[model samples]
Target: MLTDHHTHLAPDDDPLDEEALSIERIVAHVTAAMDRGLAAVAVTEHIYRFRVAKPAWAHPYWETQTQWDIDAYWEALSEAKAIGFPLLVGIECDWLPTGQEVLVEALRGRPWDLILGSIHWVDEGAVDYDLYSAFDHIDSEALWRGYVDRYARAALSGQFDVMTHADLPKSFGPLPSPATLGWAYDAIADALAAGGVCLEVSTAGLRKAARELYPSRALLERCNQRGVPIVLSSDAHAPADIARDFELAVEAAVAAGYSEVQQLKGRDRRPVPIG
Candidate 1:
């Protein structure tokens, strides 16, 4: 079965808000995935959108952010589960070195199927969105190195089951320089190897301006070399986007030498061969 381990049940561009997220709306995304023949999906919402998580958020948008009812969230996911929807409740948690304690505290005692770690910011800038981007003003090389190091830290944190969009450095702005790549891949390979956290192979890149897959061929190869397994996802932001461009992702995984992808049942996992 093809399982999407990482995805968001939210509209693409608006500031993160829970009122816009609902079990019925998320189930619509799941229904769309069923049309694509996907057996299941993990709807991992952004944790920063929650008000209780306000202290951990560095994004300017969070300042105006007023709603964060995680109880309502669990209620929705629980509702879907109760009704037999092929869905898993999860969150895309930002892996920040400084916010480690706060994040751990915020997520403590919560029952979630998967907590996918994301490296959305390098310092104060967002790589993908222009509103919080630091690309134009900062040194590209420095940001890249820091981003790589940040992923390593996230993997070692033991707070996440999957690392979503493992190649987020190339998500926006210009291409990262080739000079520092050797060590960067090595660092990622080593971290994932040691941490046992699966790398997320996302097709969102194909939709990005870069038009490449996350954890591009070379990085995927490094992960393979280090014996790190991968999880496939589209990082679907809308109902129509569930499993979008997934055939291309399967091709990319096979080309990178991955014969199987991971499937998560709660926090537990097993391998499913790619056909």
Candidate 2:
């Protein structure tokens, strides 16, 4: 079955940023996914609602999106479902150092199909956007080690359903060195298994400079060894991008010895046969 588990939708004129999405554009994107032969897709819009960052006056745009109401999210979900398209409601929640209980309570008893836990901003408010851009100057090994450490912490916190992308920094630019990041893959895999979290093989990596998945082949091998389940997501921002490189991801999964992949149905995970 062909499915893309990560998609974002926004008005045509909206900026190419997370906060620019709208419900009207989301429905359009969902229709596009159905037309493009996607059996199912998750509408995982960005919901990084943390009170940590103090936006400067220069970045006034950041302040406009400080609050993302869950009630509004479900309303959009209801509207999308009325269109008779197979769409799932999910959010890419940020894993903050504090507010674990608040986050859990906010999501409690919600009809969400999936939850993606990601570490976008570190404690010191260092976003990966800056972290990846300064790769050459910084110690690449130490940076990657820090990323893995954060991933473990994100998983162990018991807040997210899937580890969104293990090697997310690679999305920004060329990876500094493989040895450091490669060594941490096993820890991430083990963490996923222990925390009952799945890994998302995002196709955005192929569109990156490296033209390979984020974690690469060696990391997939470690995931296989640890028996960690996986899910495939296109991380599509527009309609045409839905399921963009899913076939290649399926091939990669099979090569990694995973015969089945995961999906969500009413907050419960169900394995779908991958052929």
Candidate 3:
């Protein structure tokens, strides 16, 4: 079965509004995913985009972006799910060193199908966005190292079901040689296997300046060798983007020796044969 567990209802460039969480919009995404022959899809919006999740992060960028109500977001998704929509209710949770406790408290007791752990920000600067790029304040090598360390910690935190876009540090462009980061990949694979967290093989990177899939084929092979299960995602921010470039994602997974992908629901996962 083909499934996409990482998807965003709201665009990253825009602050989420009421229209973004409407039942109509949610169904549109699901329908698009189904049209692409996806057996399942999950609407895992960024937690920082919700007003209630603001206390979990101290970044100024989050302050300006967190304006929508999380309750309404959930209510809409639940309504869609209640009516038998073929979608999962999930959230893409960011891993912040100082806000770990607050983030944990914020996500407790919710009916989450999956929680995708991501390391978008390394300290106060964003890794992918140029407006608050971490490269502006830190050197490329330091940023890469910091991102790897944070990702390892996030995977071991045991708070998420899957880790998305493992190589986000290179989203904007190329970095130092992979030889310099080989140890980081090994460490990440080990942490993910130890934590029992599945690694997301996302096609979103194909759309980024990196022009390659997230986590690279080398990292995917490392994770596969460590027995870290995988999930496929497009990281879609719009209905039309659902399952975008999934052929390449599947090819990459097969090339990495992944014959199965995980399907998630109510925080539990089951393996499905990859096509």
Candidate 4:
């Protein structure tokens, strides 16, 4: 059996309000996933802590939404479970420098199966839509080093279930590798190891310019050596994106020397056999 480590679900309410994210659409998508033999999916909706100037790429439905109520979150998970769908409750959290309290309180008393911790913004004052733009003034080594350090903090902070993507900023920028930075990637890998953070083998990179999993092969090997676990995900933003590249990602993990991957059931992670 296969489980999608990350997915988004549209709620069914207020035809106009949820037209795009209606439950009908999400169920259709889930049905499609079942057809492909996927046993379950961890449903993660976006949770924001601050206001921002909307970007052109922002989804219209999400433009005015700022937070998700704990009640609403549980309701969605309950409904999915009632329907015999093994849905895990989770959130894609954006970490702010000062919002840890708010996140902790919001998560209090809630049984979250998986939490995808992501740094959607930098200290530069605005949320970076094109994450690669973060490396504009810095060399590749410094840029990647900074990003990885932040990831290490996020992991050690104990706020999330897994680190979403380790080196996503490169998807949007040009950088010098090995030329300007001597083995900076190794340092980043070491940070992840020290922090006890598990790396996500995201397939989304294949659809991006990088066209490879985050952390790359060498970094993954180092993570394996450090005994860090790995989980697979498509990070599916759209309904159809569920389980988009399981075969390729699993192959990549095996090549990186991981013999097993993790799956969540009722907030507990259990191992799944991998070849």
**How many residue-pair clashes does candidate 3 contain?**
0
Clashes of each: 0, 0, 0, 0
Off by over 4 Å in 1: 12-19
lDDT of each: 0.80, 0.70, 0.87, 0.66
Q: What TM-score, to 2 decimals, does candidate 1 have?
A: 0.94
Give the per-residue lDDT digits (tens) of candidate 1, residues 130-193.
Answer: 8868786687687788788898999988989998787776767665567677778888889999
Whole-model lDDT, model 2:
0.70
Which ranges of candidate 4 are over 4 A from the true structure?
Answer: 10-17, 49-70, 125-128, 136-142, 179-184
- TM-scores of the models, in the order given: 0.94, 0.83, 0.97, 0.82
> Runs in model 2 with CA error above 4 Å?
11-24, 49-64, 125-138, 173-178
Lowest-lDDT window of 10 residues in candidate 4?
49-58
In model 2, the Cα lDDT at residue 177 comes to: 64
Whichever of 2 and 3 has more lDDT, that candidate is 3
lDDT of 2 by residue, 85-197 (tens): 68888877766656556566666777788888887644343334553244545455655666677888998877777788777766554455656666777788888888888
**Model 4 C-alpha lDDT versus the unseen true structure:** 0.66
Order the numbered candidates by lDDT, best leading: 3, 1, 2, 4
Better of 1 and 2 by lDDT: 1
